[model samples]
Target: MRRLVGVLVAVGLALGVVSAGPASAAIDSSGSAVILPPDQDPFYVPPADYGSRPNGTVLRSREITALAYVMPIPVHAYQVLYKSVDGHGAPVAEAATVLVPYTSWTGPGTRPLVSYQIADDSLSTRCQPSYTLRVGIGSPTGVGSYEVSMSYQALLRGYAIVYADYEGPHSQFAAGPQAAHGVLDGMRAVLHHAPAGLDPNTKITLWGYSGGGLATTWAAEQQGSYAPELNVVGAAAGGVPAELGAMLRHNNGNLGAGLALLGVIGLARAYPESGVYGILNDRGRALFATNEDACTLDVAVLHPFDRIENYTTIADPIDSPQARFLIDTNNPGQATPRMPYYNYEALQDEFVPAALADGLLKDYCADGGTVKKVRIPFSGHITGEVQGGPGALQFLADRVAGKPVTSDC
Candidate 1:
């Protein structure tokens, strides 16, 4: 109880989210606290349980970003954040996706709210996450869309799950500060668009896995200055690389296999200032040609083991002093973090560097921000969301309930 109160006060001071109405017990539609019980399946719904459709007001799983095109198959009805217009009187593309599992509601309505969650990658249209079995795995196989799985889950829960492709159209790289803007905007788009039937002032929460974790961290941190009007009760994130610079540096040398190469190549493709092109050898250049524009997951599978092993020090011939400067600033420790973070990291992560995680956590702790770490005994480098998702959900659930997160596993 004390921890929960501390979270409210700390979050209010940190994000400046003023509570408007009386606070009540917060929770998702699901009655389960954190892990779903043995009888309940966390991901899928059985055919026998597909009963009558929800009369609740919700635009589930549909892509309403007003960007290029609205993706088909509304994931299901989730609690949306808000919506607004841009400077030119255009609709601001702000939104996030959410999934609510609830029991009998004593609240205002039966229909769940529209909501959103950010995708876990840098801004890129690359098809790495696509898969034959999964829609968002980054491979070109399968249905090649994430909404299908999201919709499948939402329907079973009788709630909506919003999928915020927060990378924006340009797929910006390492723009951590701008993360809050994208998240808030994406979430707002849903709230404003779907409030006719659902509650306009319904409770909202944010949760994410990996790259999405970074966005969640930034959104919570910058809630004070960005979209103060939105009633964002709590946000939960897992596997936070709190400091981007430290991440870059730690991964630069032979820390991990495909990760550093892919991350560096991706960042270089996004931000040229890191001198990425100059550091690559002929073999590295060939590899870059194949994957400079590829998605993170695609690089993980396609590149044979031999090609990934070549990822060594950023500067092979370290005698030259110029390369040293490039190496120094890329570490996560050197980069300054800009927001309050619900940070989590894996202890034996093959993708994320241990040194980077340690340094970033130290800094965030010093800043008096809320830090939640879920140390995975297994390596979650590949399927980060699958591994860290349950914990992420519970963390956000606590925050929305106005509780401090004590589940630091």
Candidate 2:
């Protein structure tokens, strides 16, 4: 969210990098992309009982109703990172919107909603990633980032797109409710600034796959309460790695063990009670020094999971007391949602455990939450990107049409 540090974002836009022809207009003035204060535009507040929030905004329910409106889009897109509280009132980072108009129009701007896309580690520029290589990792087609596809989908539906690096630049894998705060705050920046080429009424539909699924679930659980102004219609989380605890135990000695490492790092971040941070002595600290900064989730997947084998075990990183607490927090998908939610799981997934998926489904059904459970037959975790995404779109469209949603889902 900070001014994308001029880290020379080593990755250059490749040949086929396409920004869908501008279907919108631009801002009427010059701008710093200046420094802004946190909570200048309050959205989040604590407690189920109503209370006036950050900007003296009154909350009727848990949801923060009216969104700050921004119009007259800016010529160039600009990004800023600031801190704000999540639905649970925890301080977090937010990435502001940068509107780049692709069209010319003078008529009163239509307020379009934004669909958010959570990418993997490709978000950081400090080390300069190979865009081509990163795109390939996200999509084997070697064609484009998912946002390219997601943007087209949003535009077709008459909504703008907002790509979120919910993991922040550091890529916190699954911190749960804390992640979405930034995503929603960014939506606020878009609404308040209404950068020249962007829409003023950009509502939101949180969407993601695999690693991105964490953001979708986080944002959905926070909506109707955190940033009610975003008017989040719904959310779709594909390849839901619902339970991190199961993922580690099940993935032991398997191809998916790498995810366990990512979970350790993330959970340790969100729940300090997990005891991962202090367990490691100077030796354990050294492993993180070399590994944490350079390692991506994918690269870590190639490991030995035997009790004392390799990085997979995260062997003896924390004390027994702290280790138990961290392991206990492994279940993430159990969130009691405040909005419509759908999650897809690959029955044969080597990345996310099936038991976790099944357990989450049972909890969701029992909680009386809105859900669509799609079990991918004979598929791994990524199939949902191709299959579940369209289903989610249909679900969102139905909600927008004010049509009844079937409980059969």
Candidate 3:
């Protein structure tokens, strides 16, 4: 609790979100006391039984008016709180926003489903896409997550959308398996949801970039073995940090360090056995504690040239066995996906090194997987999202139509 408070206070101070609220400073939510200042609204906490339910079991649901940024489409939306598993296979409740266009599918057969995972790279639940998609206000703390708006294009393409919080109730950020489960199970929830009118065997495609890409890739890998019943057509992931260890090495002392550290902190949240706090030295521990509740921009802009070594007690902090295992365990591309994949990366990506995408593609192809690799020129990490999103959408359209995908590798 002290650690949680310290993180909230430090982030509140740094983000200027410290203010008194109508309720008490601390309120119990799901057995944890969350410090809610006036500037920061508390995110939804699922009930204890949520986790005990079967994966994809919808506990409760309500129809919501989903407003897209520039699109005037009357999107039929529903908020679903469904059962999901964690990295450890423990039960958890996760929420997803399902948006169905009023227009019918112009293509053949059933309407295609796009499980869009936004790049919700934050430890704060306020930044989750489910919260940001509503009409009321943006992220409660004003972190400004606009990725949900990007889903507008998918809606424009007439694809039924299932956007999961992905990070689960705790905002497990970069936790691979946890995010993967939320995504796959969220798809399950959307498919089984009676109001959505989706075919139980609908063609599904996973799409995301950066953090979202990590979740997409992980889900693609886990689908064949984890949830084999879901008919996933394909997956498109761009600017994926396939290996967190490689990401740490690439971002250390660079502009991406702040956002990169969030992944480290996230890994700690995901894998308690990894000893994130145990590995950190005094300065590292303090830094980690201060940024506990920090969002993507808060971390990225605040400490641009930070180095991970400065926070650790040992000479090679990430080189330890525990750290290595944690990173490797979360990294994707080891498990060959059962479907064709579209992966892209910018050659000049400043945040995620292109080599990460290249390595994943190479590994997937070597395992007899059909993969299409695209290298976006004259783009950096952030620009790659804009360049890659449309192509991924097109790929999903083709895949959903049962088009044969020829490998670009």
Using all chains and alpha carbons, the TM-scores for the candidates as numbered come to 0.58, 0.67, 0.87
Estimate candidate 1's alpha-carbon lDDT, on a 0 to 1 scale: 0.43
> Which stretches of candidate 2 lie above 4 Å from their native place?
1-78, 86-92, 96-112, 119-151, 196-202, 270-273, 281-283, 295-298, 301-324, 327-330, 333-335
Candidate No. with top TM-score: 3
The parts of candidate 3 lying over 4 Å away from their true place are: 1-48, 69-73, 135-137, 140-145
Off by over 4 Å in 1: 1-123, 126-160, 195-200, 249-256, 273-289, 302-342, 353-355, 378-387, 404-409
> Relative to the true structure, how large is the alpha-carbon lDDT of every model?
0.43, 0.49, 0.78
- CA RMSD (A), model 1: 16.3
Q: Which 10-residue window of candidate 3 scores lowest in summed lDDT?
A: 19-28
Q: Point out the worst 10-residue segment of candidate 1 by lDDT.
A: 128-137
Model 2 poorest 10 in a row by lDDT: 60-69
